[model samples]
Target: MRKLLQPILAVALGLALGLAVTWIAGESPWHVLKILEKGAFGSGYDFGMTLFYTTPLIFTGLSVAVAFHAGLFNIGAEGQLTVGALAAAVVGAVWSGLSAPLAPVVAVLAALLAGTIWGAIPGWLRARRGSHEVINTIMLNFIAAGLTSYVALYLLKNPDSQNPETRPIGPGYLIHQFGIFGGAPVSAALPLAILAAALVWVLLWRTSLGFEIRAVGQSEPAARAAGIDAGRIRIIAMCLAGGLAGLVGVGEVLGNAGKFKVGFSPEFGFIGIAVALLGRNQPAGILAAALLFGALHKGTADLDFETEHVTRELSLILQALVILSVSADGLWSWMKERRRPVIPETAGGVTC
Candidate 1:
């Protein structure tokens, strides 16, 4: 019960704090909250948009969660996704003549390969040179941005258009949207994301490699003593994490946008960290958390028109507060501990 209640309490506290901020901004918190609720679920279209935003969050959330399971922090999901999207765009554009069914498959494979290689670099450095993954991943993000930018600008740029994006991918490469909400962008990727989550759950709990990864996360020394190659596990975990994140590109580029845009991501990679943390790194929890954040993203779109002082920035504030509240569990426990009275030990078996 405590485990279940913790997240609920944290969410409540975060919303309470967000309401306080809203009051300070000279707005009615209740009104703003109502607007948020209505906008996120007012119609089928609204719900579909929420799911559309959620597809990528699931991938990125799982990417971070998988690395956390291996005691590794992969902050380079942005880079991996960017490069993977570029690869998918290139494959789709240059090989437009491929058969309908084969094009998307090949594009997806290209994305996975690109992301795997990008992720493996930092993993290799960490395993072989004792380099910190956090630093390496951060640096890799910048490199990926520059490299992808150059390719998009110089090589993949559609000669007929001014946008810094590749040409339209072949129709064969596109994933069909369900059109459940009258032409919303929700595509087959939503189901794919859920399937990936299920696969990840099975992989981490039902496989030997998963056991080794968790064992390494618990203690490298113990894992080593037990004949597990901790370094190799970390590297493998990182690669898997990268591949998961790379799927974000498959959804956005191949499924929705049909091309790689220069600034397609709205910091989905970084937002994933909060998702993983709020979800407690559990697959089911990640799904719930992703949906919540997705709702926030979808609802906040109309803030400018709904209120005079409030804007979409309220979403960021709410997200930050939630992260802070969730992370403060330890500090709250520490404070309680400090306030507890120490029991006196009596000498000679005498009690006070």
Candidate 2:
């Protein structure tokens, strides 16, 4: 019960704060609410957009969750995702003469490899030089951004095109759309994300390898006593986590854009940490939380289009507010107790 109520409470608090801000700025509170509502679920198309956005979040959130389970904080998901997308774009663009059916399969594999390599670098540093992954990943993000930008702008740039995006992948690389459901733009990658989440959950909880991961995370000395390779496990865990981030790349490029753009992700990897936190690091919870955020992202634009006074970025503010409320859970707990009637202590003649 509490688990469910917490999300409700967070959302309520966030809405209240957002309405207050809008009202103070001389905007209609009800109008903003309507905008948000209509934008997120106005039609089947909107819901499809919600799911399209969510697929990547689930993948990236799971990536962070996996790292957290291993007692490592991976702050470089942006970098991993960037490299993965770049790798996929290159493969899809250059690999020719292959059957159209085999294109997506080969492209996704290329992305996974690039992301794993990027993750392995930090893992190696931590395993060998006792460096912290947090710092290493942060630095790597800058490098990845610069390198990706260079490729998108110069090396991969379509000479005839005006944008800083790469050339479009061949027609065979496109994911088919299901137009019967109100023209939803959902791609094939959504199912892959669901499968990835389920497999990751199984790998973490139901497998012998999962035990080793938990053992290494719980205590290095104890893991050693249990004959687990602590250092190797850490590296493997990082690569595994990075692979999930890479999947986000697959969904975005192969499923959505069908080509690599200079800026593909709108910080999906970054927002995933919040999703992981709200989900309490569980895969099932993460799915729901990711969908909530995904809806917010898709719906916020509608809010702006509906209400000229408001901006779409207000959704980010609401998300931040929710995170704040969740962080202050202790206050909510105390208030709940305070509002309840006090019960008399039970002992012999306790009422008297």
Tell me, by lDDT, which candidate is best. Answer: 1
Give the best candidate by TM-score: 1
Every candidate's lDDT: 0.87, 0.82
lDDT against true structure, model 1: 0.87
TM-scores of all candidate predictions against the true structure: 0.94, 0.90
**What would the per-residue lDDT of candidate 1 be over residues 1-352, giving only the tens digit for each residue?**
8777788888888889997898999999999998888888888889888888888889889999999999999899888889889999999999988866899889998998888888888888998889999999999999999998898899889887798888888889998888677677888788889999999999999999999988998899999999998889989999998888888888898778888999798777887887888889899999999999889888888788999899988888888888888888675675665587754663334322
Measured with C-alpha atoms, the lDDT of residue 314 in candidate 1 is 87
The window of 10 residues in a row where model 1 has the poorest summed lDDT is 343-352
Cα lDDT, model 2, residue 155: 80
- In candidate 2, which residue ranges exceed 4 Å CA deviation? 328-352
lDDT of 2 at 21: 82
Positional deviation of residue 92's Cα in model 2 after best superposition, in angstroms = 0.7
